[model samples]
Target: MPQRLELAPPAFNRRKILIHTAAAGALAAGVGVPRWARAQSGPMRIVVGYPPGGGTDRAARLVADRLQQLLKRTVIVENRVGAGGRLAAQQLVNTPPDQTVLLLANPAVMSVSPLIYKDLKYDVQKDYVPVAAVTDYDFGVAVGSALPVKEVQHMLAWIRANPTKANAGVPGTGSLPHFFSLMLSYMAQVNIEVVGYRGSAPLITDLIGGQIPLAFDTLDSLLPQHEGGKLRILATSGLKRSPFSPTVPTFKEQGLPLSAVGWNTFFAPSTTPRATVELLSKAVFQIMSEPETRAKFTAAKMVPVAMTQAQTEASFKAFNTQWTPVIRRSGFKPES
Candidate 1:
């Protein structure tokens, strides 16, 4: 009887058992694999803070459309409009760590709003991570047919001469246009009233109708009218001349010593895995780098930009450092 063959059951080591159990639990929660890998089953969403047909919305749609083709998955743009993009940002912050949702944010929501809104729901630095910057745009000093000016210097002189009519309409208060207008007036030693409108549409209407002598808005907002002869863009706020309107000199070129540029950037919740962010960043860079995409953005008056994740983060931090104190000193408060 081979008694030795009937060996006792193998010893059960507690440590080995526990280790195996923990690893099994981790894998059950989908922890070992990246969240984005598991997220591929669901449709990806790009949240736009603004309404449809707006610049931010358009940029989101462009990225969404191409990303769908590249990934062979469904992509949609969700316009979570309100509070000048604050609501959408807050919503994003509250969302659990997910790779399927992203936000298309503007400079106002990222740089200026946080500085001004004391009760803002989300902290731009802590709540979100920059994925990529899709488009870069400049502000334009546009004048209606009423103002007889062809250049920024001439426009400043006219504002100085006509003190009663020294007013500049802005798309919104606490916007780049509003701050830039104030900076322009201060640098040029003029007293131009900064008027805030509901949005670019109304401000542009006033400009075209000659109700407002001059307006400060995005180049894309004013470029069509500027080209249509409904208004004249005296100067653009860029370090260099815009390719869309190359003849138009920049504020720096015109000796104003000032320039401000804005961008539409994609951001994800801070908890999102780095691998997920890299995946989306690579897709955006590829789409924006394409010649056809560049042409489309150019036609829409937005300059296509293909910045890496690190570059996008650097640009965002730089803007916050550069503009926060300036905004504080300006004493311009948003109308809550």
Candidate 2:
């Protein structure tokens, strides 16, 4: 055959080919950019009010890691610590509802602070919508050697007999542990003078050295000392015994009919689109349900909970209702 003449192939339009492929992808992936991917165009952040290494911060970091993988976006944990978490809460209030920032807050910031702080800058209900509940933890009723009380009943009797010496220390003034200790006093019909410490370390030091006769703090904070036999945890403020301290009795189990369960929940600015909130909420639920997450929470003495938006809100509301009367009855004055 004389030279076989073959028509030259049409020149490839790289841009046009890319455009077609992308359009085909869009159609295959369902009409437009996925809602999640669109919302995640920018980096996401989880804001924690407490310093790093604390329970809330740790939980936020864990979630950030998993969310970065699931959403294929950068995620970071920001510690906006000040004013016992109020500063962070206020920051969230002013933050745009772009779904880039979310607050990992405890009951102190979410439910108690608003009730106790007269000059609170943000109304939680109006400023933020609960996205997910990450963990549930309870307070520990610990007694020092100076008090010499082994049980809640014995502690109550001691408080009654030594009313002038009945001082209970808490990690912070307006913290749930403070109010929880007061609730114990109110229920037992004994007077207890509540004192606030800077954080758990000093509170724990005082508890061990008899600087304070009794103290209440998170079960996680008190467990080490209690387990070391430096102090004793008379009771825990949960409906059931803590998994970490199965030997310890609950306040209700000890006939107090009182419980103080605290949770670390995530909240986004109220103006965030419902679709964004739902997407983030689903991701959180998935992360919390993972066995690795549960193991980490358990190791930290916190019960892992993966509550949806409505359930988280309801839990927060019920917590407010449960503690409002006790806080009011304790006569805790608001800080300016």
Candidate 3:
């Protein structure tokens, strides 16, 4: 019989062909790319504007801890507290994009501060890129022991009756809380005397300890005192009641439909690579969606408001646009 012939994958020639094909695919992906790319290789830093133990600092730390493990890198939160978180924010802009420097800041740092500080060194929108919004710092209107008001309805009535006794403490001279207290008064048709303190910490301490009769403060910062029975929650600043504390109704529930409070978000230097920005955003959404992250935020009384990149950008622009008129109306004159 004639010699039988069989066909199979080529021994050495076929192996080279396979290798070349794989290399081609990887080239389409990126250089140094494996079938499954490893995480970024470097120590990472998340910069926070405030000192440790405060709500903003605490929130930033929470994210840093989970993200360090998620990205398989060393993540440290550097406390750059000063000028109401301005120093930390400015630092992010100046840092090299490749360093992975990020600002885990609240909305005030992004929105309100610039309006008040006439020559703010940094323009949050122009200087920084939006990473991912963590959540809103939900607030509540509560009276201290020094005041004789408890329920939202009673507080409204008292404000109308004793206009002079309606002095309330806000975070600072031109803070969101300041405008918020003013807006609340406008909606309630009452004259509210706003008193400014250095920061939310002192304002909150006074409110609970009865030095100030009323205040508008972050829910995360105020929940502990409310739970400790040091203050009485008159109304939550949310449009609707929070599931965390169902007993305390929302402002709308008390017939104050104007929703005014503070919020927080994450940002990166505008110069950061798009790949890095997208990577950070993807990580943020994943972390926020995690069960443990949700649980921690819920316990802290933070109300999450997830936004797509486009949406957050539009929102930032809208906030910047709208807040100008609002600031002018609030009797704020930016220093010359």
Candidate 4:
């Protein structure tokens, strides 16, 4: 059983004591006490699967800072970086259902890892419950200045014209960008090679230096360079244009049958009580709905989109269903 804190003491007297006793009896019968009435009080943690400074980490910190104010508890962000977020996810799975710990995760860890990893320790569906949807970001395809292509059609044509220089850089192997690149090639009828890097820094470094002609990564990471003319954004991997780069067209608009939108979401251990989940979900929705919060995320190149708990679960289910087939078709296998 989870520990509970007494918020206040009842006044000592026969009449007051009778009222307190009656209230206790009702709570014991599971009648009138609200779910949050038993909420645990302590320092809360928001775990990030990746190291600090990445988009997910930044978002986690942003939420943690606001959550502290909303919940009136000390909220901390913990980084358990490894295995592409699997390590941090497993940690959350093993934690007690006290609702004091949550994982700030992305689709890469929740939806993609299950499809790719053969020896994952925790089951995403069975071990975790969706709490809230945080932010949605689209991937952008950019070409270095050295590359002559300025649009999707031009880039595809350039790939056909110069087959040897048709390789694209992805931030990591088996990542959304990696598979999106594969889908792009499949749809465009072009054979562009994929080269995976440790993270976006090195990938963007080589991209600007002409080491790689094309790169695919989150719009947040690539939009700055695109604005500075260091590179050209051909298309974004969203059904609609990104608010941060509204001038850029989506792959679908550019005639490619591909769209990849990723999100940052909150999750708690599956065993957590429904009331606890609802409490946290409502808190997150309130935080994300604030105009200041929305502006902060927007300035960070992330779109703030809050969803109800049911909607969050439905979105996760829909995303998982949509990506499973795509992952299988990619024929990607993790290294032992």
* Candidate number with greatest TM-score: 2
Candidate 4: residue 336 lDDT (0-100): 53
Poorest stretch of ten by lDDT in candidate 4: 5-14
Rate residue 103 of model 3 by lDDT. 86
The per-prediction CA RMSD against the true structure, in angstroms, equals: 18.7, 19.2, 18.0, 13.8
Candidate with better lDDT, 1 vs 3: 1
Q: List the residue pairs that clash in candidate 3.
A: none
lDDT of 2 by residue, 1-336 (tens): 112222222132222322333233323221122565555556788899989998788888888987888777789899999988889989877676655788999888888888778888999989999898887787888998888877888888788788889899999887788887776666667777888998899999988998899998989899998999999999987666777899999877877676667788899988787877877777776677666766777776667776556666666677777777777665677555
Stretches off by above 4 angstroms in model 4 are 1-39
Displacement of residue 57 (Cα, Å) in model 2 is 1.0
The per-residue C-alpha lDDT of model 2 at residue 32 equals 29
Summarize candidate 1's per-residue lDDT along 1-336 as a digit string, tens digits.
Answer: 111111122122222322333334323221133444645667888999999998889888888888887666789899999988999999888565554788999888888888888999999879899998887788889988788788888887787788998878999888898887766765577787888998899999998888989999888788888788888898988777878888889988888777667788999988777787887777776677666766787777677777667767877776665566557767877668
TM per candidate:
0.83, 0.85, 0.79, 0.84
Model 1: how far is 9 from its true place, Å? 75
The whole-model lDDT of each prediction reads: 0.77, 0.77, 0.68, 0.77
lDDT (Cα, 0-100) at 30 in candidate 4: 17
Error of 2 at 62 (Å): 0.5
TM-score rank, highest first? 2, 4, 1, 3
Model 1: ten consecutive residues of lowest lDDT = 1-10
